[model samples]
Target chain A: MEILLAIVIGAAFGAVLDRIGASNPTVIGKMLNLTSLKLMKTILLAIGTGSILMFGGQMLGLVDVGHMSVKTAYVGVFIGGLLLGAGWAVAGFCPGTGLVAAASGRKDALFFIAGGLLGAAAYMASFPWVESTGALQGVLGGKVTIGAVPGSGYDGLFSALPGDIAGLVMGAAFVVIAFALPERLNPRGERLARAH
Target chain B: MTLSWKSGGVLLGVVFFLAVLLVKPIGVSTQFVIFDGILWNAVDSAVVTQTAEGVTSSNAYLAKSDGKYAKAVANPLNYSFVFVIAMMLGAAVSVWARGGLDRAERTMPALWRANFGDGAGKRYLAAFIGGFVVLYGARLAGGCTSGHMMSGMMQTSISGYIFALGAFAAAIPTAMMLYKEG
Candidate 1:
């Protein structure tokens, strides 16, 4: 029943992504631009609200801290990041956002999703070689989260910092960006609103 | 001026949250799973059954420690991944409702025209390459940009931090090249 509810919630979430133009790759892609900070407001708002909900839930014990997950460090990720970012710049889409784009009637988005699926399939088909190449054998480890460490670390440790601190930092960063950015530029998912 | 009924930003956040609360918290790398699932389904017929250690009766897969892998295949109705699928569906519905569901000609950057040849082929090709890169990175960094920049940061994962660093670093060059002055 809960999972079913989750699906409903998930569907609603997707609907929102479509309405806001988040599913549109270009709209979301600009967030990564250094000069643009195009996504700063959306980023800040998400981080801010996300922080509040997450911490509030955890603080109230409505959530379990232990169940959260992260991955082991690997060079594959580094290489992938470069490729993914480059792709975003070129094509203006990510997996999730791409899905939304396709949903929103962008045939171009459909192409991206299909392409990703094909690429993924191709990788899997070649996995035996990719794996045997030890291409991804950098540091094999179990699922680990930031809180798992006794001491703080990574991304200024502030970004990696969880709960209120991270929220405050991300939120503050957004606040600064909000002040720093122009209102005329429009927010990330509001592309259509900004367009005409 | 007018907000559409499809509101995507809050939904992005909402799905991001549901991801953690339900199935696998944080990252989902839809391309990876679909791609991997297809392969595993083909190869051992046991890959999909392969469950994470210490988990029992998970809706995704169950690890028995009995060496049989998990008991079930991942459902399309769970969180994160499902959220992504739902997102696609939502977008489809929204676009249809808005009457913006038709193909249109794009005439923006020269790069768009040169690469896509002012046709559907270039656009789709670009998308395909984009997906490939993202999944590869997700598999490599142990997460996607979403997992890293979005969920990873939220969860405070070291890998997420490291993954994000790579994403940002790479993003600099890519953005400069693509979005550079006309």
Candidate 2:
């Protein structure tokens, strides 16, 4: 039963990823180049909306904080994040989007997937050595929230600010930004030429 | 109607909401880890036994006490594994419906050609290296952008917020240096 639901949801998620041009390396590269804001807008809005729904639900007692998985802060996570970003810029596909691209019949994306699997395997093989390095050691034991909302399963800097309120403000800001940005700019378009 | 970024973003948010309500939060990397476990278990049963014994490294899905691990060891068809397969199937269907299967198969995209020259081998190598590094880094970090940034941020986690800032801070500059227009 859960597998069936996953299939349905996964299908919708994959379709949305493709529809947003995430499966296209050109589109992804453009976003990375800062030549386009379309993908950024989409990501910001999605995260913003999700933040609102999640925190808002928590506030209303509709969502269970216990169920949501929270990642912990670590020195390694910060360094790893930078590396992941560089990889995204170079490869033009994150793990999820790479799957979508391969599914879309991109043979190159298949190579990327293979590489990713190998990478995962490598990490597992070196688990002992890597763990010994203290990179995966969590500073807060894996539960820390930005706002430190009381009763929420997180602790962080902004304890006074309600998490739901923070989410609302962030969501509103993202929505406004999404609205303000144009979808695309044509090189021949007068507005683009005038800016140059 | 063609799904624009605006509509797609809205739909993604809705799907995320429903996913949280119905199941656990959406994550993709753990599915890969689960794959790694299954592969290692098949190639060398000792690896599986060691993981189960907590002698090597502990994985939630490979632990003997975990029901999912039991089901997976019995037959590699746990929920996360199935979800990964379903995600691929979904993308296939979407591409087929949208008539994008052929066009999406290009080996050398314009961006790669512009930045790295038109060598297909070099481009593929770069892709492979990038893939390896990203996945390894994600494992080191305990999650990827989706697992940490999107889901964690939704939960108002400080780690997610910091990860996001770190990612963009590095990604943008790296991209600019590599692909800056002359």
Candidate 3:
């Protein structure tokens, strides 16, 4: 039953990703380069809205706090994120988007998938040495939330502000920013047209 | 056939919210590791061994979490794995529904062509290298954009915010340096 549900959920997620142009590398590249802001706006809005719905659902008792998974805080996570960002700019596809692109019949995505699998293999092979380096060691209380929530196993960084409320406020901010962003920061096409 | 980005974004948000509220958060990077483990286990029977306790892997990473990953390796039909496969299928379905790839999609994107030219091989190589770097970093970070940035921020995890910061900090500059034409 759960597996069937997974397919439904995953398919919906992928379809939306494709509809929003995330399956296209040029769209991603444009977002990162500020040549186009459509994808970025969409992403910000999605994240903001999702955060609001999730935190709001939790507050309304429609969502289970236990189901909320908090990844451990570690130095490696931040460092690795930096590395991932560089790669994202270069390749213009994250794992999910890469898969979506491949399925969308973008041939380059196949190469990306192959590369990703090889990369995962490399990580598995070096897991021991990486672990020994202490980069993966938990930091900042291992798993924690920005603000405390009742029944959540994770600790809170700020006790005064409820985590759900914090999420809601931040989500709203994201939505506002998403709406405010211009469609294009570069407008190179328009500029070139004007020049001609 | 494509929805506007705004509508798509709302739909995506709703889907993500429902996934978390009803089941679990959406994640995809871990599956890459699982895929590797599965293939390795097939090649070398000793890579993963099932015992009375549970499935165990000779690989330390897979062996951690009480062999939870090893168990997934042995039984590859878990929710997460299936979800990833479904995502691919969904993407393919979307393309087919849209009447297949149009000329623009079949070739290089305008922005990419403006900066990098229309060499499919270059794009493929770049995509592959980029994917390699991203996945390698994801494993090191213990998550990807979906798991850590999107899901974590939704739940208000501090690590998620930190990861997002690091990602954007590097991504913006790299994009600037790489694509001046765009």
Q: Pick the candidate with the highest lDDT.
A: 3
Docking class for candidate 2 = medium
Tell me what TM-score chain B of candidate 1 gets against the true chain B.
0.62
Candidate 1, residue B142: the lDDT equals 49
**Candidate 2 segments whose C-alpha is farther than 4 A from its true place:** A140-142, A149-151, A180-196, B50-75, B102-105
Q: How far does residue A45 in candidate 3 sit from its true spot (Å)? A: 1.1
Instruction: Write the candidate numbers in order of decreasing DockQ.
Output: 3, 2, 1
Point out where model 3 deviates above 4 Å: A187-196
Q: What is candidate 1's lDDT per residue for A109-186, written digit by digit as tens?
A: 666666676666565455556667665664434244433322322222333544434543554454455456553342
Candidate 1's error at B84, in angstroms?
A: 3.3
- What CA RMSD would you report for each candidate? 6.3, 3.7, 1.8
Per-residue lDDT value at B152 in model 1 = 66
Interface Cα RMSD for all candidates? 4.6, 2.2, 1.4
Ten consecutive residues with minimal summed lDDT in candidate 3 chain B? Answer: B102-111
Q: Considering TM-score, where higher is better, how would the candidates rank from best to worst?
A: 3, 2, 1
DockQ (Cα-based) per candidate?
A: 0.40, 0.58, 0.75
* Candidate 1, residue B58: how far the Cα is off, in Å: 22
Candidate with top TM-score is: 3
